[model samples]
Target: MTFHYTRLANGLEILGESMPQSRSVAVGFFVQTGARNERPEEAGVSHFLEHMVFKGSERRTAWDVNRDFDAIGAHYNACTGEETTLYYAAVLPEYLFAALDILTDILRPSLRPEDFDTEKQVILEEIRMYEDQPAWSAYDEAVALFFGDHPLGHRILGTVESITALTRQQMLDYYRRRYLAGNIVVAVAGRLDWEATAAWLAEHCQHWPAGATPRRVTPVVSRPARKSVHRPQVNQEHMFLLTPAPPVESELRYAAEVLATILGDDTGSRLYWALIDTGRADSADMSYHEYQGAGAFFTYLCCEPADAAANLEITLETFRTAVRQGITEEEIRQAQSKLASRLVRGNERPQGRMRSLGYTWIYQHEYRSVDEELGRLRAVKREHLSQLLEQYNLLEPTIVALGPLAELAGTVFPAS
Candidate 1:
């Protein structure tokens, strides 16, 4: 199976992967606008808009939308993020056209006053719900500290107060600006004819409005100033260390990914053997997050309150050791192989391939074949990983910890 691409008369991108061997079609609509696009006063508008699109639309009630998809045995859902809002589904190829129609209708939603009022309450409740969870709340605080004044720091779910005060007019106004043909990419995968899909889009979307894909203002991420979050109520400690890194497009990102795996993977990872295998921590791992022109490497460690201080020191030493001694050639080869295996296994299903294509296009604005991706991962060198660890100030990290402060009191919590 391979990817096919084109554009509609109205500028909606039509992306697809021809998979004649598969029985289902995995399709998605990628919108370039998200939380970062919102102003301070309208913090949760993008997420709110995601919910409103499902509440009701011009042609179908939310129930009808669900029933129709269920009738087709469709797997459909939508999610909002800091940089993108995606609506996707997998269904029998026969139902592909209908699925696309349902999606397109929902995309251009009818923001009814009554529905907006109800959804606002629901959104506020969601905010309250997340606040109750220590991990979610802690991460939000970390982001606030990490990103500071940058729009990237804004939470996708926004705040309870912000959602509560948000008006239907404000949401409608934002929808008018951000949600349009130009900002969307329609991607589909699996046993489908690209010609038919293209014609289907031409009929449905050619009349829709047009605009260019929205671009995010890349943030200048600095080292964390005050990194600890002391939530005294929780039983255990959740600690995360952050260091700035490269974006999705940068060649160095592949190296960052390899470095992260070697440092934090479940097994054979430096942090895993040092922290998790030792039973000093409940879970510990490293992950790399990449956006348009900004990215960060995160090392997350969770452990019993009693081990907080020891675990914190161990985690720091783990990175410091990597910087000084560096990873071995054997370790780099193993990490690369592991990553390549994961990528191949993950894309075995058309749904996974569907998502990969959408994100690659949305973020990189280019298509990278599976072979190309594997080649890049394979190309990573021991020096690339070691250089990044030393070049980036991975040793002096901005730290954020949540949970009981008693056991971790003086040692883990950096003075804010």
Candidate 2:
């Protein structure tokens, strides 16, 4: 295996990880703009634009775009998140250039008024669809509650009101501002020729303008609060406890991930034993989410309305115990092994390796092999977890709940 990196004169970065044994190649265009980059009035434009990118382009109709990928038997998709948007495809090594051409063409979308108007309804429908899910709706609200006025808390799928009023001009303006050459990374992995790939990108992307979009990186300050929404139509309760954690660039990120797995992995975890296996909750887990300059740790549970209070207490107790006593060496060892195994297995595939390569460069501007990542995971210790628990003030979290029972919001748990 070999890694390659190149930068065009216009500042576009092209990266490739060549795996001799792999039969498929994964290509991705990662844009450094998402929900957080939008102004208040342009809330969902990033995601809405993702949909429009597929609607049509100057050289290809929407049908042509879809049919062409199908012609090559490629698996392709795109998604938008809080901090980034990705367009990607996986194809046999022979179809690498075809896939790359199609992806690059769509990046310079026509953004036709007709296409924009048609996709507006689709985006609105998507927002309504997610609102119908109790867990999804609760988690979205929890992020807003936790982040307060921070732009990082903005919804990836804008609210119905924002989508309804957003205009095509606003989206076009945003595109021109954020979609500069320097703000994007083209990443590919698997069996490929790096020199040929780099030359292709350099020629095709020469016309793209060069400039980096600046991002606001205000430090997040979280406060303890509790809120609940009554969704009488839902049969189960969804709850989330959110607190700060190590950001993407932090050295403590490895320890934070291990701690989350030890406390809340789906099976053979502290949360599973106290909640799921005990039948106190239908689902329970703790996860760490990292963004460019900020991060969050989430503890989530779903249960019958009647068990909401009891389960909430149990979850709090689990966190308090870990904070007070720290975790056992055996638990740390198991978490390291579980995480290392996942890393190795995920990298075995070209698509997973492509994603890792893109995101690592986007966030850290460096590369780490599978061995280096496993080493980081294995380095986590009890003292590392202890430091994270104290440094992040993980014991105090903003709580959000959604269900048939409004009373659950008022239930209180003791602090660490």
Candidate 3:
């Protein structure tokens, strides 16, 4: 991999990774502001601004944004998360410039008032859709439990009240406050003339002025918390357990990933083998989320009310035992191998490469070549795993459950 970076005078950070083997080029336009940066009153503004940008830009209408890309046989989309709003595009290497243009136009959109109202309704419905899904709602509830009143506790889509109350000026104000050149990064991977690409972006964004430096997200010490919502209408109960861990840059970060994989990574992992295979859970999985300044290990299980209590107990006990008794050499090797494979496989796609590239750039603010990352993963050992267990043991965890929980009194779950 070849890497190059240039900082625009106003503060835009542009970087690119050249992969000549692939016939496609992936480009990501990332802004650092996310749900965590918003004030309680400004809950969904960052996400809303992300949507409004695509509604129309200075050079293209919303329809044109999609139509032009389709004309070029390109794949393009955007997403907003707790820490960043990423707009990405992938196309044949020959069409790299066209894709870049589309992304640039979207980032500098015209926040029309009429479009704001329309998108607000769409977003409100999106929030409602999440409210209706038990599995999805459970994760959101878990985050709230883990973070309490912190901004990270709020939903990225925010509440209906927050979205509906937002005015065009409020949205534009957020754009001005957060969408500065310094807050943005343009990253591309797989094929391209870096010099030419940099020149093209510089010419277009040269005059873009720096706005206020977005507020830095403060790291909160998350404690354990629990919430149970009994919504009888849902057929199955959703249970989420979150354990606080270290930041992305911590030494124990990779161990946290291995632990999550051992518990509930996929169909072959412990959760699925113990619960789903035994008919204790209808569906289950665990994942690790390492943020800019913090991390959380989450284990999620959805099951019938008949098995909910037993399933929850078994899962918690399993984790506690592993942390205390230590993992076997086989389990440690398997978990590490699984995680390593996932890291490699994820980079196979253009979008995945772009995501990994963009995330690594933000987390490290410098390039970590693929070979170097793999080396770190390979060096992990069982003693290191035990040390990690001692460091991030999830004895107390934040729990969120949505279902017919009349049978379950307050379980001694973790408090956030």
Candidate 4:
């Protein structure tokens, strides 16, 4: 395996990880802009633009884009998130250049008025679909409550009103501002020659104008509160608890991940045994999400409306015990083993390796081998978990609950 990094004169970065033994190759375009980068009026434009990119480009029609990808037997998709957007494809090594060509063309979308008008309804429907899900609504509200006015709290899909009022010209303006050459990275992995890939990108991407939009990286100030929304259509109660954690750049990130897993992994976790096994909650888990300059630690639970209070109490007690007593060595060992297995297994595939390579450079501007990552996980000790629990004050979490029960709104769970 060989790793290569090149920065073109036009300011675009190309990252490649060569795995000679692999039969397939994966390529991705990582854009350093998302919901958090948008102004109030431009809400959802990043995601909307992601859809339009596939609708057509200056050089190819939407049908041609899809048909060409299909012709090469490629698997492709795109994602928009709070901090970034990505478009990626995986195909047999022999079709690498064909896949790269299609991927590149889509990035320069025409954003035609007719296509934009038609895609608006599709975006609205997508937003409505998520709104119908109780868990999704609850989490969305929880984010709003925790971050207050912070852009990190902005909804990726934006609100119905925002999308309905958005215009094609507005999206085109956003595209021109955020999709600059310096703001994007092209990552490729698997069977490929680094020299050839670099030369190809240099020639093809030379025409892209060079510039970058500066990201606003103010420290995230969290607002802690207890909020509840009454959703009559939901048969069960959904709860999301949020607290601040270390940012993605913190050295303690690996430890934070392990602690979350030990506390709320889907199975064989503190929450799983305390709530799920006892049937007090249908789903319970904890996740730590980190962005460029801020991060959030989340604990989620869903249960029958009648069992909401009891389940919440049990979940809190479990957290309290771990915080006060610290995690046992056995628990730490188990969490590390589980996480290590997942880390190594995930990177073994070309697609996964491509994503890892892209994200690492995007966030940290560094390359970390699978062994180096595993070492970080292995180095986490009980003391590290204890430090995170103390530093974050997980006891005073901002909570959001949604269900048929209205009384939960008035109920208070004090931080002890």
| lDDT of every predicted structure (CA atoms) | 0.83, 0.91, 0.82, 0.90
Candidate 3 Cα errors over 4 Å, as ranges: 211-215, 407-416
RMSD of each: 2.2, 1.0, 2.0, 1.1
**The CA-based lDDT of model 3 is what?**
0.82
Backbone clash pairs in model 4 (N, Cα, C under 3 Å; residues 3+ apart or in different chains), count: 0
Model 4 agreement with the true structure over 1-416: per-residue lDDT tens digits: 88899998878999999998999999999999999999999799989999999998888989999999999999999999998899999999889899989988889999888999999999999999999999999999999999999999899999899999999889988989999999999999999988998998898898997998879799988866898798888899999999899999988899889989999999899999998999888999999999888888899999999889878877778778888788999999999999999998899899999999999998888988888889989999988888898888777789999999885733345566
Model 2 Cα lDDT, one tens digit per residue, 1-416:
89899998888999999999999999999999999998999999999999999987899989999999999999999999988899999999999999999999999999999989999999889999999889999999999999988999899999999999999999999999988999999999999999999999999998888998868799898898888889999999999999899999998999989988998899889999999998889899999999878888999999999889888888888888888888999999998888888898998999999999999999989988888888888888888888899888766788888999866844455756
Give each model a TM-score: 0.95, 0.98, 0.96, 0.98
Model 4 is weakest, by summed lDDT over 10 consecutive residues, at 407-416
Alpha carbon deviation, residue 414, candidate 4 (Å) = 3.1
Off by over 4 Å in 2: 409-413
Screening candidate 2 with a backbone cut-off below 3 angstroms (N, C-alpha, C), the clashing residue pairs are: none
In model 3, state the lDDT of residue 134: 85
Clashes (N, CA, C under 3 Å) per candidate: 2, 0, 9, 0
lDDT of 3 by residue, 208-264 (tens): 877547556677677767778888888888988888777888877877777778878
**Residue pairs of candidate 3 with colliding backbone atoms:** 223-415, 223-416, 224-414, 224-415, 224-416, 225-414, 225-415, 225-416, 397-414
| Of candidates 2 and 1, the better by lDDT | 2
Off by over 4 Å in 1: 406-416
